[model samples]
Target: MKIGLYFGTFNPIHVGHLTIANHLAEHSDLDQVWFIVTPQSPFKKKSTLLDDHQRLEMVYRATKDYVKLRPSDIEFGLKQPNYTIDTLTYLFEKFPEHEFALIMGEDNLKSFHKWKNYELILENHSIYVYPRLSKGNVETQFSNHPKIFNISAPIMELSSTFIRKEIKAGRNVRPMLSDNVWHYIDEMNFYR
Candidate 1:
């Protein structure tokens, strides 16, 4: 099986995230796209993030109906400041029979070289990059790379940070989030 891993904190799972996953699963060579919910990203600020379990539950609620899109808690058990290289190595060891690929936005690709063991990641795994709004075209170095494939997924300007701000301001964020996720957030009074 060729699984594409889409990693994020998912502070609250939103439609943009789901859309990317759906597009990758449908349009790419991947058999499935797993939403690897990171408890805390090394590059992101931890102050604004929700509790790990809460974020995980939101992911579960949002992805419950999609067979091709599954929510993963693989990073939950791992230590803080999870690194992509370490996660990929662990996944490779545990699921030797399955082929793993990385799913990310073109914006992330711009900073790809800064990631830990990025060269190894490019050599060992395939990467499916979706277009992101506001990000410029792919750089020449990675434009024609064999392991990096550019996908035409819709560019949603929506973001988790924006949604959080809306919720905190008591605004309706229904359009930004999945039905169940919105309901869960409303019921829990999250981000308030």
Candidate 2:
């Protein structure tokens, strides 16, 4: 099976995430889009993120209804401050039968060169990029790369950071999240 790895902290697993993942799963050649919950990302600060299990629960709830979308806690057991290259390598060895691709935003692609062994990752796995409203230009090398596919998915401006801020300010950002995720956050009083 061709699996698209949508890696993120998924602090709350909002609807915008679901939309993009589902779009790629249904429209692209990928059979399944796995939401790999990152315990700690090398690029992100851990201070703002919720507990690993809490975030994973939200992801599980949000993706439960979608056959093509699934939640994974693969990174939780991996080394801290994990890099994409390391994860990809581990995944390839662990799931030799399944073909894995990367699912990321245009914003991430802009800084792709800085990632650990990005060239190696490009050589082995295909990348599926969704549109994101971010600044800066993409590297020329990646512009017409055969392995990189620019998916014409919806440009999701909604961000987990924005949702967290809204919740902290006592604002109802219910529409931004799935009902189950919203209720989970509400019950746990997270980000408040």
Q: Write the per-residue lDDT of candidate 2 for residues 73-188, one digit (tens) a residue.
A: 98888899899898888999999999999999988888798989998999999999998876666555698999999999988899899999999999989999999999999999
What's model 1's TM-score? Answer: 0.96
TM-score of each: 0.96, 0.97
Query: All predictions: root-mean-square deviation over Cα?
Result: 1.1, 1.1
List model 1 lDDT by residue over 1-192, tens digit each.
999999999988899999989989998889999999998898888888888889989999998899999988898888788899989988998899989999988888888989999999999999998887753555756888999999988997788999999988988899899999999999999999
Candidate 2 residue runs with Cα over 4 Å from true position: 136-139
Highest lDDT against the true fold, candidate: 2
**Residue 130 shift from truth in candidate 2, angstroms:** 0.7
Sequence-dependent TM-score of model 2: 0.97
Worst 10 residues of 1 by lDDT: 132-141
